[model samples]
Target: MNCEKIKGKVSIRTVLESFNLFPVKENGKTGFYFALDREEKVPSLSVDYINNKAFDFGTGKNYDIISIVQQINKTSVSDALKYLEKFNFQPQEIDQKEEVRSNAKYEIIQVKEVKHPALVQYLKYRNVCDQIHFVKEIHYQINGKKFFGIGFLNDSGGYEIRNKYTKICLGKKDVTLLKSGMDCQREVKIFEGFFDFLTYRNIQRGANEVSDYLVLNSTAMLFKAEELMKKYNIISLFLDNDSNGRLITDKLFNQYNAVRDCASIYTGFNDLNEWFCSSGRYCDY
Candidate 1:
């Protein structure tokens, strides 16, 4: 079983039974192990001695390997193999490093042409016009494709778009489903991007109540929040506490009513996730 499945079924007894092994307990589980040792006096096998398929137990903890074999009743070799496969396990460690892409130049590597039917459905759901420009980039690597770039809505504002007199690419943002309208919810929370919104969702998992979510695709779209604010009773702005973020928040608060800035909660760090990780707080938020 995978770790999640194992955890789901695990109790102390169930765990021991699963391995056909029992702990040599003393003093209510606080005791040293009494088992046969190797030449170096190391326990020959133990629960800790886990491998790709099942764990081992130290000697003197007499266990019938056949008992386990019998417990998994399979009529054929293929069936037995299938049953055993679920118990297979592997131990691995991986370290990840962040590679910064500073001034990285990329060609219009490739375009993912969206099928018209799906594109129409998506645009309809977002209340976006059909003529709003759309394109997706497919990034490639030596092995194969690396990442699929986000499809964006063109806003006709960026330097490249201005030169071409066409719409600028405004990267796609997810629309969160609120249980109720923002005005009736009592608390409205805003995020600069969908990633930030999702990170906030992770941090606030199992929270007492679900708050309203508003994701502004870019700082330039901060003005768009005015219409949403008119409909919402309480607006909580969680913009990045950076200069641009602050400028956007100030502008929104000054021009719109019933808007409050909560970005100050993470003033030390430039972004919410960074601040949350660095704060050393007990809660994820």
Candidate 2:
């Protein structure tokens, strides 16, 4: 399983319990009793189940399951991740009510060519219509109500669903990989989301300017792209200017000497789509 899947699906309480370390309560809230620093009368490590996160009151350190695993075992990230895989914490199956609700909650009703005027305008609004023909219109239902969006399928068969009022993934999350018609292309281009890929296509205007494409959908999904990217002679990054973007770009930069950070081209914008919008119709994340 991928890091995001493990971090999200594995409960830290389960991890703590498996390690034979139990949490203690002081002020009526449940919390762990681990000592990250000097021991004290009150237990300092607290697990927040609502957020699926933890915090060390002593050191004022916040943690996710992966980080918590690293803390407990003093192990590296990859090792902690492997440690998590042994747990068999499959993503809990969508329970009965949820099965019904998920059926009702934007269940895909239909998918077809990008012919919706609203989605067409949404793309034109983002200035990415040059590649409009490649996208699809996804019609779904939630609570017996219907909705639609422009959809792009990623490598794992998940749809990156986006509309003016909403943005979400409809299935398993994964990166979108677009190959150069010829295999072993010397270079690849990276973007944080599919719109950025479309934005790049809109700017570059034709197939000649395009290289292989990797649309991460979420910056956190960068790890899934790392192995495939190593095959290229050059890698150009068009990630957002935000913290997540800078951090992942740094990780990619370290491993590949030939990787290039291309965000400088849209210096003040948060991302390629935002730059393309230029305060156009969609002001989004």
Candidate 3:
């Protein structure tokens, strides 16, 4: 494809997301991204999805979606086009309609406070037995197959279902918010997954710290939670030890001055839950 064709076929938002340079959704077709060509404390790259173009004030440069990718990766035009080819860009209206239909495939059968034996064992194996109160025993059917898993509710009324053999989401995907009862500075803890939240609780047992919790369910969902999160005076992140987590933490740190990364506590493990499980077996079975 040529320049205009390449730009029109690829969504800049998708391209940036593929690079893990997530941008906040501004409105229908416009979103603000961090400077792709320079270091910035704020988002200076404005992307227009409808127009398939972007302009970065940090670098005083205007570009189409292809040029943005080319700039960030320092790749040639042909290579950048090759990278953009990985994403299937579609009009937002059509994509949303199809997404709703696709999301309808999963049926949530029942959700209640955790009480299932197998789920209890699964929590135990993850070293989060005491966290049963926060999660639900979820029974769901997908693609004509019935399955059960531990479910953590997200802000958009979706459930992040997780079990030993399966992981999926039902309904709209969003972040999970857990508010600590006691009052404190507007400090909030951010976790990549609900299991990490449970692990943090297990590790910080008896502390009874009053802090808000935000679980993105997936690192890609961090941008979805950024608006409400900006109110916090301090942001503590307990993400996994993966590259995606590191990139997100770095982004949050740069954007929010008070952001603190607590990943050091579980430096050797993949995530907080892994570290918690490695500590000891607190199984009830």
lDDT tens string, model 3, 1-285? 567776655556556644544454366468787677655556788887677778887777898877776787789999877665434322121222111111235688888888888888888888888878888888887567788989888887878777765556677766788888766657999898898898778767789687898898765455566667778899988988865577677767767778889999989888888887877758453
Sliding window of 10 residues with minimal summed lDDT for model 1: 91-100
Clashing pairs in 1: 1-86, 156-168
Error of 1 at 218 (Å): 0.7
**Runs in model 2 with CA error above 4 Å?**
1-106, 279-285
* RMSD of candidates 1 onward, in order: 23.4, 12.6, 13.9
1-285 in candidate 1: lDDT tens per residue?
A: 343343332222222323222233323222222232222223233333122122335433432222233333424544433333322221111011211111212234445544445444443333332322333333322123243333432233211111111112222212233344333566678877544554565566567764567765444344334555666667788888654566566666765678888877777776775665564543211
Candidate with the greatest TM-score versus the true structure: 3
Candidate lDDT (C-alpha), each: 0.41, 0.70, 0.71
The residue ranges of model 3 lying beyond 4 angstroms of the native Cα positions read 1-104, 182-185, 281-285
Worst 10 residues of 2 by lDDT: 95-104
For all candidates, the clash counts are 2, 1, 0
- Model 3 has an lDDT value of 0.71
**What TM-score would candidate 2 get against the native?**
0.63
lDDT per residue (tens digit) for residues 1-285 in model 2: 788887665556545543434454423235656554454546688887556687887888888888877876789999888766544322232121211001113478999988888888888788787687768999986556688989999787768788775656676567899887886678899988888898887777645753788887764355566668878899999988865567567766767779899999888988888877884543232
